[model samples]
Target: MKFEEIDLSPDIMSGLADVNYTELTELQEEVLPAILEGKDALIKAEPGSDKIASFVIPALEMIDDREEQEGASVLVLTPNPDESQQIDELVWAMGYHAQIESASVDMDSDAEEQEEALKSNVQVISGNPGPLADITKKLRYVFRDVKLVVIDAADEMVKLGLQPKLKAILRRVLNDHQTVIYTEEMNEEVKELTKLYFEDAEIIGLEDSSHMLTEPPKVDGMLSHGYIYVPNRMKITTLMAHIEETPTDNCVIFTASKRGTDRLYRTLRKQNLKATSLHGKLSDEKRAQRFANFTNGDVQYLLVADIPAAEIDLQRVTQVINYDVPSNPDEYRYRADLVGSGKASRVVSLVSKQDRSDINELESSLKQAPKELELPEKVKQKLKERKKKKKNKKKSKNKKRHNNGRNKRKKKKKKDELELPRPSFDKLSGGRKGQAKKDQKSGVIGLIKELFS
Candidate 1:
């Protein structure tokens, strides 16, 4: 659809033309009209789908034209600082002609400055959910007139543990508001939110199949999936060996946990490998620096744990290795999709015995299992020795348990043999001489009768 066909304001049209945005993408064509109509919507959009423009343009169009408006009319919730910045810039460029005032709540910036900006009677506001939620609590009037709410990268927000904060901001804006959520697909988290808060929301681009995993993931055809079956203890060795053997222009190694990423990064650095790491613990400045280093060809290897998909650019990545297989099948597809498009890229996974269930899930999602890759000879030797040690440990434990059981049985048998009959013991304990003598006579009679028989 052409922008000229829509009944948008002349100012917005001029802004769009300035940016060379003439025709609407498929996602925009489907979502733009619904948002303009004040209907709640859940849109499924892949990366690079130009999904941001759909909501951002409509959000700009919906701002109350009056200059005396009290609070922000549009609230945009992003997953990270980068996305928030992007929204702020886009809103500025598109809302320029209309003199739309927008404020971004940045966590890394001076709090006083952001607070001061919020007090300027901004028409649009955007920020990460954490800062946004806190801002809403302090400045309750900021969202008092919210006519539209855009949850950009809804899945990423949930992945970053921002769901509660998102809920907090939504709860405060309790008035009749329009909600628009953009995600890769209709995940469980997004589905639950829509059912709970979004009334009869129109879900766009979602397949009728369950979880949208009925078909295989749409990854680059040139990319290959493979795994190296190694023992958990030898995973590090296997990864190092693979790295040494297969050189790449750029590589991304994903660990299952932050501690694992740290350990792997330290090990690689110890070996004098040109490597860096990315994780949730790093400061935003440090993270951005390291990311730039990798993307700018300054670094060859990047070890990451729990990085949002939007943060990583796959264009320069040539190889991807999973140091620890992820439990979620979606993670597998995400890693697979990280390979550069149209390049001979490949994704290798270090699969251990504990990752069997996760591998099965990936297979189900991919419609085929990852091909098995032979382990390096050195790694194989280490794995063999580790298995041998584990086997010996198991045997020792079983032997110790058997010895303990045998000793317990011996003690019980000895105690049983030493025990006396209850009636004889009772007669001997009695203080009456007559009773004792009668008991002795009965005992002697019984013995004499046994001997005669």
Candidate 2:
């Protein structure tokens, strides 16, 4: 359904228009009405479902109608600082302001500075429960004013042991406020928490469906999903050759670790390709900058760890290369679905022998093997040639090092011989008389030699 059909305010409608948002996604269309009605809600949605806006729009609309007041009006609790910042940005982009009470921010900053930076009547807070408790004590006024509480990634929060603090926060705000919880999974713990907080709330489930408002473009249609089994050493070479031949405008390569991401970024850049790396090891500012570059078309390739699966939106990504297959079947499905969104035209995964068990489990869980394609002969040949060249280079470097080591040893021996002490005249003859006579004779001879020269 179109967004205009919803009961949002005119100002919000205008804001949506400015952002070019015309219609609602399935989840949004289903849950937004209940949220607008001020009914507590528990929404089950997966990644890439555009679920952020499902609640963000209604929350901002509600806060907009309330009179300006002290303390935050809306509180969004996210799993990590990254998601917290992302929520803040969305709130501000909708012409509202938000504050992120991330642990990274120093505790001594004045509340006014904190409020000003957030730019809204809303505040996004993320931290461990202990530190969060301390910070909350200092901002009792802020908690007192919060009228609505949101918990994003509810399942992850429970897994991270923040459920107790979350429960306490909900209890603290229960007097006259509404609660909304969103999660990708509906496990028992999540179910229990929702039951406790949203005793009489509405539950909205957005199941994976077969409906699409628009068919993806033909270029995206060309993509064939599949897997290949090879030794681990061959995966990188295979991926490099694939990209070298059919270089797409933009691609995202996912690895399991920060080290892998860095290695891939360096290897691709050494081939004279532009690439950037992202992972938890980087500062938030750097990660945001790299994400901006990738989104703005300044960077054509992004080598990242799995952290981006839930956070990044790559609208023009032409390819997704899974350098390492994920261990969890659900995670594999999530990553595959994330990359296969209309944003990316093709998804390519490189599976190795060691990953066979994981792949088999994923296939069984998903109830199907991904479609498979044989490696094109040209690409296969290119990969073989690259491997051969790399092997030869390694051998040559090893031989050169061996030869240099021998030469270095020989030079060291010669220097040691040259530095050895010569037999002394004083040791060969009677000590004092011989030394004095030699010194006088040597002085006279040296003077005569200098005059003659």
Candidate 3:
């Protein structure tokens, strides 16, 4: 059914058209009506499924005239700051940026910002559960007024680490209000969250998440995997080599540590490679900017750490590089998930000899081995040529330095020539006396020699 058939607000339809959203994706089609009818919803859709707009569109319509209200009537919460900002983008994408007062609440945000986020007039607030829970606990008056709550990326948020906080926030929300959950899998936390918070909630499960190897929506589509073995020393070099050989158009290189991402980003920059990085170490604004640039194709490559792996959408990346093996095996797929929403051809992971076990775990997770990939003979030869050129360059540089040393000795002699005493016109008469003496001596000697002859 078309969006107009669903009786959505005319303004929302206009915004949807502005963003070229002509028809709803399957997930959106399944979930939007339940949400519009003010029913609790449980959504399970894969990455790149346009799931954000499903909730965002209906939420916008439900509260368009609430701009004059004092407190937020609807709330959307995400697991981390990156996802929080992403939700903010979707809200704006739907042309609700002006009509909806939104705020992002994160642990790193200052108290004043957090307090401002609590404004009842701010109808939409997205943020990490910890900070949101803290606000609900401290400022119940503001959050209790919440009428609709959306938990995006529900499976990840339902983990024990974040579950209690999420539960507490849910408990404080007005019981009469609606709770909508979006998830990829029906994990225990998801099951429990639905049981506890959503009574008679509409459940929309796209596919069985248990058969992860075969059942994920885009897995059977145009996607493949490959691996490369780099001696511990040459991991980055091998990665650079792969990038040099392949199309890195909107690629993501996954690094394990914050420092790894920063180091790789800076190293690539020094080599004049155009890329940016994302990790917890950066401010929320910086991470959003880097993600935006990569999404918009303004930058070619993104050096990222693990937190963003499963969270932010990597739109149509043709390549993904695992710069290092992730600590979690699930992260291997998360990295792959970055590229293979459908169009990814290969996800090349760089595995060092010592860390070969990481690949083993990855295979175990996949239940099979990916095609073994070796550095191409041509690329290898090219790298060797590059190496030779680099070595030759260093030799040439040293030769220049060596020649410069000898040139300094020649220069020293020239400097001595420059230091010779010069005649001053001020001493013209005094300098002539010495010259006249020398001439007299020479003339006397010449006369004596001539007489002897």
Candidate 1 to truth, TM: 0.46
TM-score of 3: 0.43
Top TM-score prediction, candidate number: 1
lDDT of 2 by residue, 169-287 (tens): 55555347788888888665776777676566677783321111111222223344567664445666777777876678888888999989888888888898889988877898998
Clashing residue pairs, backbone N/CA/C < 3 A, model 2:
97-119, 97-120, 98-118, 98-120, 99-118
Q: Which ten residues in a row have the lowest lDDT in candidate 2?
A: 209-218
lDDT of candidate 3? 0.72
Could you tell me which residue pairs clash in candidate 1?
Answer: none
lDDT of each: 0.78, 0.67, 0.72
Best by lDDT: 1
Better of 1 and 2 by TM-score: 1
Candidate 3, 363-425: lDDT as tens digits: 766744556788856557766887899999999999999999999999999999999999874
RMSD of 3: 16.7
TM-score to true structure, per model: 0.46, 0.40, 0.43
Comparing 1 and 3 on lDDT, the stronger one: 1
When 2 and 3 are scored with TM-score, the better candidate is 3
Task: After the best TM-score superposition of candidate 2, give how far the Cα of residue 69 lies from its true spot, in angstroms.
Answer: 4.1
